[model samples]
Target: MRAATGLWRWRHNPLRRTTDLAEAWIAFAAAALLCVVVPLTGWAAGSSAHGSLQRAVRTQQEQRVPTTARVVRQADGPGSGPRTADTAGEERLRRSVVARWTAPDGSVRTGTVTTSRRQSAPGDTFPLWTDRSGHPVTPPMRAGTARAHALIAGLMAAMLTGLLVEIVRRLAVRRLVLTRYARLDRAWAATGPDWGRTGTGS
Candidate 1:
């Protein structure tokens, strides 16, 4: 609204200079882009990210297999201390155990995997996820998680677009202001010799 007011005030005023109109137009253009382009960019980015992430989710579901592993013994090694960090919050609290399971190819596989059982002993069982080759892998991404990632990507893209627009607007305005100042200086210099005599009827 302020930009509109400035534009209207400068539209036909006798004192309006070229720089004044240009500055007003720049402000209006910037406002328009912020209102229209920013949201569109965000939506496009989010949609693209959603499609890619969903495809990955589907691929993981197809390639991974779930099976029950019989615990062979408690895992004791450098990497088997404790699951302090995991994608699934509850899994982070689980203890690592060496377990054996049959692969999709019917071959026996053994690996260290996390289990929720507190007093796990040999022959005890826990659910596990592995690839067809029998290597342990993280579970597939959930739909909700994919959506969350897409949303974050969209927000970041929108913020970056806004910042770039703002920077361009500021630079253009600064250039216009500098040009206006230079013109003023030239006009003043041209009239300097007669500035004092104008009031003396010379």
Candidate 2:
């Protein structure tokens, strides 16, 4: 009998409605699932994108041919080298190779190619390289590192998950508050009219 009474009271109680509780629980569960799945999806997408970019860059580099080129001049850094220190007044000599080639339009163009890795005179003959697209190629750009991709993926997933959780939580709290307010209104209406009447003196 006590259990039955308790159940009856709970059903009509403004503080503990089944519908409100269920909504809150569902919201919590949905948020939890999103937090787990968003990161995994972001990581997979980032990995695939990074791999595709790297492959494209590699293919472009491989098409260029290695040619004999002159070392025009070495780019200088902040610190002077041992040779520079020893030579008080000797100017560093730079050498490079120049070649002329006709384009598809039959226009002759001259370009200089330099290689610092080789020790050669200014007039040394070397093959200049042209890429598959017939354009002079430079070094390929470096792709994003694994660590950078991972960090990006993590940040993206976190933002998505946080947004989803906040939205669900807000909706759930709103529903709970509305339901409680409705119950309070109904309870107030059930009170007898005499409860609000002022006392009359005979």
Candidate number achieving the greatest TM-score relative to the actual structure: 1
Q: Which one is best on lDDT?
A: 1
The residue-by-residue lDDT of candidate 1 on 1-202, one tens digit each, is: 7888999999999999999999999999999889999999999999999999999999999999988899999888412322334635765466778889888899998877877787789999977878878787777789899999999999989899999999999999999999999998999999988987887887
Q: Candidate 1, residue 61: CA error in Å?
A: 0.4
Candidate 2: TM-score?
0.47
lDDT (Cα, 0-100) at 191 in candidate 2:
66
lDDT of 2 by residue, 120-159 (tens): 5544454445554344444443555544655676667667
Going through the candidates in order, what is the number of backbone clashes in each?
0, 1
TM-score of each: 0.85, 0.47
- Model 1 regions more than 4 Å off: 78-94, 115-119, 199-202
